[model samples]
Target: MHKTRIGRDGPNVSVLALGGASLGGVYQDVSQGEADAVVQAALDAGINLIDVAPYYGLTRAETALGAALKGVPRSDFVLMTKVGRYGDKTWNFSREATLRSLDESRARLGVDYIDVLQCHDIEHGDRRQLIEEALPTLRDLKGQGAIGRIGITGYDLSVLEDVATTEQVDTVMAYCTYSLQDRRLAGVAQRLGRSGVAVFNASPLGMGLLTSKGPPDWHPGHPSVWAAAAEAARRCEALGVDLSFVALQFALQTAAANGIVSTVVGMSKPSNLDRNIEALTTPIDPAVLTAVEAALAPVRDKGWDVLPGGGGKAGK
Candidate 1:
């Protein structure tokens, strides 16, 4: 894996960071053994940056990672975790809650200071606290030596745009906004890059919407999206390839070309890790990618809200 710096002052991390939500099995049931194996595989493959959250299977992923990293030296990897979203559907972005959350994450991951501490899922909460309190709290922790850097993660582009320019944040985790179906992150990409904010993109496969299995029943993909995604998947199958491989190749290479710091992909099984590494090494067929993009035109930027009250359309 290639290396890149997170913001101007953050740690040097692998271009392909391992996302922890899949270890928690947000889309399906993930066995503990499977999670541990993938974590080990990522480390063996020279992956040093791992991103996790308390809400990922309600802390199950952190527990597994802690067990997986037991014998490894702490300085060997850059660990990052999130605060604000605590439960399956609960949030607490207050400073007090954030402090407690950071402590819990450290204990779970067996670390003294997280390399990157991010505010997770910021779209559902009050923007003022996130901007004024939560972000400053991460900075405070940095000052106190509890964290190395600070940032925010969310699916909403507008909320992300606000936090990207907060001046206190050092990184941003954007999902679904920079994928094959959406390039909305480009709207704020230049500004964030110029401001020295490292943007880590997740959901490069669009939460399985671009895969043959389609999205899980709980994913926010709309009905029209399902149709277009199915058409794209069919085209991939005809070309003797999986849509996910194409999706990952397109998204990660594009992000690298665009100068995004890293692309975070989750894998519950170790085999997926190998495939991802291979996808990065091999060149993608542009003809196939162009066909898939054309097939997805109907669903492009249909705009589904991740938060209640239909709030995901801003900054598009």
Candidate 2:
């Protein structure tokens, strides 16, 4: 894995960062052994960035990741986690809540300091509260050496842009926005880059929509979008290729070309890490990619405003 500087003057991180969602069993049941293996594999492979959040599995991710990283030298990876949005509908961005969340996360992750402390899903919290209370509190923590940098993550690009441009943020993470079916985040990442805000592209698989198994039933994409993804997956399978490989390849390549710093994906086991590593190292077949893109054209750039399982609108 190759490393790049985050923001204009932030820490250097690998381009293919490992996400902690799978460690928490977000997609399926994962054993403690699997979590340990994946974390070690990522570190050995030079993947220096590991992203997680308290909301992922309701603090399970942080707990699992903390155990996985127990013996490993902390300097081996850049640890990142988020505040607010503790559960499906729980959101608190107040000053006191933010501080308490940090302490709880630190204890859960067994870390003395975090590399990047982000405001998770800012669009879900009161916008004024985030700008007026949460963000300022993070800055204070940074000054005190509890956190290294400040960042924000959300599903909506406009809200991410609004906060990143107006606030003193070092990075912005937008999930499912820069995948094969959607390229909206590329433009937003470029715009944010101008201001020295490093952009992270999470869920390059479109939260499972691009996978061969198809998205989870809770995915909020429109019916048409799901149909198109299903068709694309069929075509890929017919051609004896994995749709996820093409999606990951396209996302990593396109993100790099557009100035995006990293692409985060969930990997709970070593086999999962191996497949993703292959996607990063292998050369994409132009003909196969062309076919996949054509199959996905019907829903290109289409998305929903609501989070997964929220039954949000089909179009933004």
Clashes of each: 0, 0
Question: Over the stretch 85-163, how does candidate 1's per-residue lDDT look in tens digits?
Answer: 8775677789999999988988888888799888887887777887778888888899999898887888887778786
198, model 2: CA deviation in Å?
A: 0.5
| TM-score for each predicted model, relative to the true structure | 0.93, 0.96
Candidate 2 lDDT tens digits, 1-316: 7899998788889999999988888889988888999999899999999999998888899999999999888888899999988877778899999999999999998989999999998888888899999999999999999999999999889989998988969999999899999989989999899889999999999888898998877778888888899899999999999999999888887678887999998998998889888888888899889999999897788877532344442121
| Poorest stretch of ten by lDDT in candidate 1 | 307-316
Candidate 2: what lDDT? 0.88
TM-score of 2: 0.96
